[model samples]
Target: MRVSQTNLAGDLLLNLEKQGAGPLHERVKRALRLAIREGRVEVGTVLPPSRQLAADLGCSRWAVTEAYGQLVAEGYLEARSGSATRVRWSNAPDTDVARPSARQAPAARFDLAPGLPDLRAFPRRRWADAVRAQVTQAEFTELGYPPAGGHLRLRRLLAEYLGRSRGVSTTAQDVTVCTSVTDGVRRMCHILRAQGITAVGCEEPGWTRLRQVIHAAGLEPVPIRMDHGGLRIDDLAGRPGLRAVLTAPAHQFPLGTVLVPERRAALLDWARGVDGVVLEDDYDAEFRYDRRPVAAVQGMDPSRVVLFKSLSKTLSPALGIGWVVAPPRWTRQLHQTDQVVAQPSTVDQLAFAALLESGTYDRHLRACRQRYRQRRDTLVQALADQLPGAPISGIAAGLHLILELPATVDTAAVVAAAAARSLRVADLAAYHATDARAAHGLVLGYGNLADSGLQEAVRHLRGAIEGSS
Candidate 1:
């Protein structure tokens, strides 16, 4: 009983040490205080003696003594010279020791989210084979901490993969792997801000996540409006002080408009004139249903554009794999960002490389492109048949299309009505950064729904929109 008691206290102290930095005494004090406040150290629970705790932590006995004394002064723990110390405070909430898990969003019978894929079609067996190959073939040296950039072979393969598939011009040396497009955006913002960039312009009806990245990096996000030709380059002329801009030039999110050729050239010229940079988010460019998607803008000027592509949409987000093909000037900084903060997961990096090397990754993509094309076609036909005169747009070359509703339609009301009927849908108003450019519409994602399921969802959706309008 005595031995088990001492070991319990020792284990707690050791776990606490790993949490933060400071003098040993201060960390010990903070950890114990939190434990008591949170009721982990329940009131009247006996604590280990200072000498035992010091030996457990490999710290001087005085450090433990000081920590206990400080807590005693704060009335968190009580110590009687002849008796063991006990927790004296109990300010914790009256509830379970662990809080209930976060509430999940209500699951809709028919989910039409823009960010999802046909999860049922994920290449599980191919992925398992890749993982097995990695374990059997990997060297002992590969087990250690991953490289600052990532697994070198994986970066090389991804560089080649992007060139073949997306026409992104780059050598293996220019690629830096990240967990997702969001991760790449954050690192780019940090590096650019470090280089004295004060602000960046993003497409107005752009992704909300991109705006969050800008805010997190302490750089201001200026919402640049878009039109039929895509983001207005002329509007950027007024903000000459802006140092960078982010675009999805191949196919803009939600609206699904491609950046026209003239604007693409002018936007590049603007970046060059201001000595600025462009971050191209090539998110779902892989699953263009109608035609072969346009090549990335990074090919136009590798020195000026940083292209971000991720497997989250193409393969599975569970893999958490992505890369940023940066200009030469920013390559070293982007690589160092992962090294300094959080390193990439080596196992995921390795499996992705194995998939690429064996041609399984490309094969999976070809299969997915076909499957997604069928889904897109099914969605278009279902809408045209069941929900006629819906005014569909953006079906030219993306996984999902947009439906522009009349200005009188209450987009939010339509979304609520759909949700009430157990159908998931999105309002375009939520995508806008500022009220100035907010449009009333629905950004319906169809790459995941099945034949009958999609037909049923659209019929319900049409009723919802009509009822709300």
Candidate 2:
């Protein structure tokens, strides 16, 4: 067998030929596996057809097929019923090896799936430093039950930070820290329900988890459509018994449309007119790519808008540190809810406060924003090159983009094909409350993938979409 290697600038190449190996299939299988493991055949890449690849390597198609079959069995390759074989992204053994019944293993290779940050870049050293400093200098009573709201230092820092960055005017007294946005929304709904508001107007294609939370709290969710500028405000002009509305005005979840100035004013006007509350989930406002982020609606009408933001998208969700700044009217009720369900960790709050105060948090946000913008551009270009006819949307901000496919393509089928290739992705249709009139597509998240990984993932994504179509 003759094996040759070429060192390309960005990619490695391995050429294998069968010589005196016991069997051609065995030789090809070993070579393919080596190429994949050694970064030759990168993850989320489509392998050549059995015949073409065999011909290139001077081997029989049977040998290539057999080798591919073996690789598939070992989770390195994926074979669709009628589609060509491709390298499985999930075959990377480092992160996807062990499985616990309770939790699913991470995806094999390029996880373009949405709602995750770059896990590799977490600031462990800085956090550890803060933890050590807090432990050494803290009062003995710091570890006790947290204040009904949250850590005073964090609250004060967040008050100033949110005002400057997100334009949410508030005092530390109005800020109530919770475990996550989900917890905050649930508590807000409970407070509203108690106030005799049995229904909340939710965005039609809003975060599914928020819908569940509202439903679980015995509140009916009235669906309102969203457009490029923001939510369809006219739909909720005079709805009765609608006590509140949950909206992601900063960047509408999944769709990524910034609420325009007119709609923002209209939403606040509605709330003021109806004496209703608006739970503004200001998720990912700081990661805007095109323009400076629009101010929070809370700033326009703080009395009616309960603003929520967290480190989930900015820093990491695992930090479990988020806060809701409501008007003084609802502060007491929110505090009572926090007391009953428990507040976020004191240690995490203190550590985050230190990060924010020391400017580490701002620096991290700037770095991530730059990196994510590049990644987003890479994915967009790849999709344009591969799926040229597809209508692309939501590329302006945030970590993900929505690629709208033709009506002839089955979204569910594409999702299954992606899964078969061990490439995790989310179907855009899945995020809608009702059937959407737009073409189907997948939401691709580039935040987690490095430059190489982003390109490869988009390549594999194109192959999967093409194969399914």
Q: TM-scores across all candidates?
A: 0.79, 0.78
**Per-residue alpha-carbon lDDT of candidate 2 for residues 292-370, written as tens digits (9 for 90 to 100):** 8778888888888998877788778888888999999899998897366767778878888999999999998898898
Tens digits of per-residue lDDT for model 1, 297-369: 8999999999998887777787788889998788888888845555557877898898888898778878988
Cα lDDT of all candidates, in order? Answer: 0.82, 0.81
Compared with the true structure, model 2 gives a TM-score of 0.78
The regions of model 1 sitting more than 4 angstroms off are 3-100, 103-106, 338-341
Highest-scoring model, lDDT: 1
Question: Every model's Cα RMSD, please?
Answer: 8.8, 15.5
Query: Residue 108 CA error for candidate 1 (Å)?
Result: 2.2
